[model samples]
Target chain A: MARSPATSLLPGITIILAGAAIGAGALTYPLGSVFRPGPGFFPLGLAGLLMATGLGVVIEARGSDAAPPEPFAWGALAGVVLSILAFGLTVEHIGYIPATLLLFAICAVFERFRDWKRLALTAAIISALGTAVFLWGLGLPLAAFGGA
Target chain B: MDLLAGFQTGLATALTWHTLMYCFIGVTIGTFVGVLPGIGALAAISLALPLTYYLDPTDALIMLAGIFYGAQYGGSTASILLNLPGTATAAITCLDGYPMAQQGKAPLAIFVTAINSFVGSSIAIILVMGFAPAIAEFALEFGAPEYFSVMLLGLVAASTLTIGSPFKALSMVVFGLLLGMVGTDVNTGQFRYTFGLFELADGFSIVAVAMGLFGVAEIISNIGQPQSVIRDVGRIRMADMLPTRAEWRQIVRPTLRGAGIGSFVGALPGTGPGIASLMAYATEKRISKTPERFGHGALEGISAPEAANNASVQSAFIPMLSLGIPGDAVVAVLMGAMILHGITPGPNLINSEPQMFWGLIMSFWIGNLMLLVLNIPLIGMWVKLLSLPYNLLYPAILVFVCVGVYSADNNVFDIFVVLGFGVLGTLMRRYGFPATPVLLGFILGPLLEEHFRRAMLLSRGDATVFFTNPISAVFMGLSVLFLASVFLPGLRARLLRQKPGAVAED
Candidate 1:
């Protein structure tokens, strides 16, 4: 029989390293007494708890319907993340309008907005409205199209 | 504080033109947003949080609160009309609601949901008023140990109480706590997690994390799926709304029962309307003479869960406003918003900022009233909103999210953080791990650390102080019990396999 999916074990295991990395990064700080604990004290304890729970998940996974990982939409995932990244990196330099248009084009590719005219119209209208409200109305101090 | 005095002060503050306008805008936006599948109140509040920065603190809070409960009113509409729930809490409504719609009772189901929601909210509003002051007064005596233990209970409950794997939930909470450890340590002045970026000094951006995880992640997951809106938006007959005497008889008992269950569950640390609705539906099913009628077009099914859903949200404010512990992620985000405004919320908030507290109470009433008006007379307008293509709608949501995060501190880096968290949220959902606890852990993480450290310090280096204090010990005991209950079942199943001779229940 084919396995179902990795219910909770994978996510549980991931948090272990995530917690340890956090603790190791802050490991240089003094642990201090319980009376006057230092920066690392709390993180160290949290990391321990994370590791403990990860172990528990491993044990639980053994008795339960352990399954393989399922397929994910890599296309949708990359498109969304890259679009937001492009928006963030360019927004400060290119300003809200052009950056948003670029972000829109990147995202629209995933949605497959087949018509270029429709995509452009949607991007323009959204950017204009966003510029009007946030930039102008809220006075966020951003130029419409380019750098100050 | 006197009840009449509180309401009088609240009314005067909330009735102003600007506050009313903002409240109206929030309610309208909330209802529309709440009706959209895959977008919840958490996403809506995070995306909207930046817009409120320019307004007066009271107006901003009032608007946020409006979005909070207005979604409660509108969420069930989608669940009733389609099998799609607008938020997790509305999922129970789909059981009987979609079935009722199948029987061509869509308008009746919507109307019943509206009425039930109103009844539920009124009871919870009363509970908030009667209980919050008393709770705050009681909380004034809470020391570091009590705070630590209560938060311990909260974190444990968040991990174990939901309908998922407890271990995964616990791990996510720990990760969130670690995330909270980023930025310079307040006590030691040590920079912990910053990889040499100046923006990392303050903390990880809340808006970025929230919008990315909920808003952008939802969009990514929903991409390329056929998002069909209601087909009969303009076609519902007014005659379909009035229920028969048989249906009316089925409604009252369940609604009252649900309201009580909702208010009680709402005050608990980690549970919220979603759990309350589920429990209420289960209770309603158990008590019915014909339990088989539940998944059919039963009137009691529609009435009970809707009543519970609204009441739970209103009363969830109690723990948040009184004890500074949020009942769920949405409330945690609201608590974070309070912190962002330079207002420390706890027992002291009611004592120090009575007007702000009471004004918020009054605005919930005002916001609920506006939702009632918007929901009934203008429901068709909402259905029309539902028909907008998801492809068109989601990209706009992305733009709003981008602007919302950018406008917070006029920084682009927040958007980048959103990108990272969005991917995390997407993966978590795929793996069947709930994302809400991560948020809860993130928001509550700092406070939990502070209280634990303080309790330790106050005890003069004794870690046993958590167990020595009676109140603190009780809460800690509860947390341990919660963990045992979650683990013992899995443990028992494992043990059963080890000793296969043990008799198993049918």
Candidate 2:
């Protein structure tokens, strides 16, 4: 019946998001009234709504019994993010195919496929087909080899 | 007379090979995407946006429009055959569809749903033909206050009506508004949320935001889950696919009722097919003689909701094209695509660009017919797709998303921005927070702000402008009622002893 930390984290997140909204109001933007509202006016109002909503959620959570939250898939997420970051960093410098191949290999590791050859083959085919479709077919101006 | 004229224009424009070819392409791609898990029409459209840059605006519109409806046509395949809904709206189909398939009625289930989809869409198209012009005529009288007020209602309704925590939904809307406030302030020419990055000057790319949030986020989450189970399909025969006379008799009433409900529900701006299908399914269950047979391969179950889902998809276009109001996120994206094509869909669209309006209408009829033909024969092919491993599918989607987002502006920073949102969206889904509100907010935020400011300027800073105008006053009343209706039960339950019935009301 007790609310676990994982369960309680939702309200905390809502409150944090609201707090961030308020902090982003940036003081310099004029907080004009409803009549002649400034850029900050709507956002200020939104922030207030977020806070009230967050508080309501927090209050509601106090009485309700929340099931324990599922474990976050940090590994799969990290793999995807890192591969994208790697692709972003290298696509222009090292060219599209190599970067995409790197992206594929990195992402495949977290997918937990035991067959390395299949993984490599799948990665290569994806990179080649992707380049052919996006670069050559679509004329995207991406570098296939290393050089510009 | 106008109907005849509209059809003539449609014949001239939509019948062309170029338009026809693009429509074919769009629908094919849409069907492919719809049959696959972990992607919806929104993400597919986002991935296609960059590609559309090279196309004629009309052709682009035709293709994108095809994808929207085609996906709806195809989404039920996975739901029925594998108990997996490729899109949220098809979730209801899984209830009776899988049951029917389990009872050796897979082919018949597919056939009934496909035919029913055709029926639903045909009715919705007729409704669109009848009502769109009248709605546009009414829309012509809408000034800034009325526009802003209605959009406010849409925002509130979209946030509140979705399946999730109401507070989180509200927060997501506000979050979307805040995100919209980023980039240069339209009124003051001031840099608001941009942290001085040059790319931030133009604000975040809608392509990056939408693709990352919907597309990449889906891949990541789907990858985390175990692989989907595929059902054996050896027993089904071609003859079994066609509904018997008895089956046809059973489905006729439910199919007609579902289409009626769908057309009406889909016309309601700020709602989606998910709601319509659920309503249709529930209605069928309630009206059925043996309600207990509802979940266990009842023919009405597959036919009704399937029909409703497709009908809602088609009728959802009415509000978008005529009134420039999107009924859901997919239509909202379609609206964005229209804007991107330098065409603002509203009252003036009918008068100014009659060809485009009529051409699109014609395309819908042709497109629905194509889907009917395409879906029935392709059921086996779509079933084959279910055998595809989740591993390669994830990589293909991820890479496609990467390429699509990166190509939008060719900015590396956009990639990072997508990464940020992708993680946020993944986390959002993991929690109970809905993604639609944020998307709805992001799309509508700028329009709402622009209209709000314009309304304020027209009133010369009169604070009562929102209430003084009867149009805005009505919208305001609706919005307030909407919000109050959502939270009133929760508030009352907290005040009094909460009963099971009270919680079940939702």
RMSD to native for every prediction? 4.3, 3.3
Q: For residues B1-506, write the lDDT of model 1, one tens digit per residue.
A: 78999999889988999889988888877787788876778889998898877788888888888887888777888888877777767878988999988888888998889889989988999999999999889889999999999888888886776665778788888878888888888877888778888888878878888787777888888784665646664456668787788878879999999999999988886677877887788889888999998899888998998899789999989988998888787788888888888887899998788888988888888888888767877777777777777766676788788888888888878888888899888887776667778888888888888888888888898988889899889999999888887758866354223222211000
Residue lDDT tens for model 1, A1-148: 4653454456556766666776676577788877799988998888888888878767777677745545677878887788888877888788889888887788778765456776778888998898888888998877887884
The residue-by-residue lDDT of candidate 2 on A1-148, one tens digit each, is 5656556756546666765656566456887766778878777666777777777667666656666557778888999999999988888888888887888788877777646677678778888898888889887767887855
Best by DockQ: 1
**Measured with DockQ on alpha carbons, how good is candidate 1?**
0.73
The residue ranges of model 2 lying beyond 4 angstroms of the native Cα positions read A5-26, A32-35, B490-506
Residue B461 error, candidate 2, Å? 1.6
List iRMS for all predictions: 1.5, 1.8
Give per-candidate clash totals: 0, 0
DockQ of each: 0.73, 0.63
Q: What is the TM-score of chain B alone in each candidate?
A: 0.94, 0.94
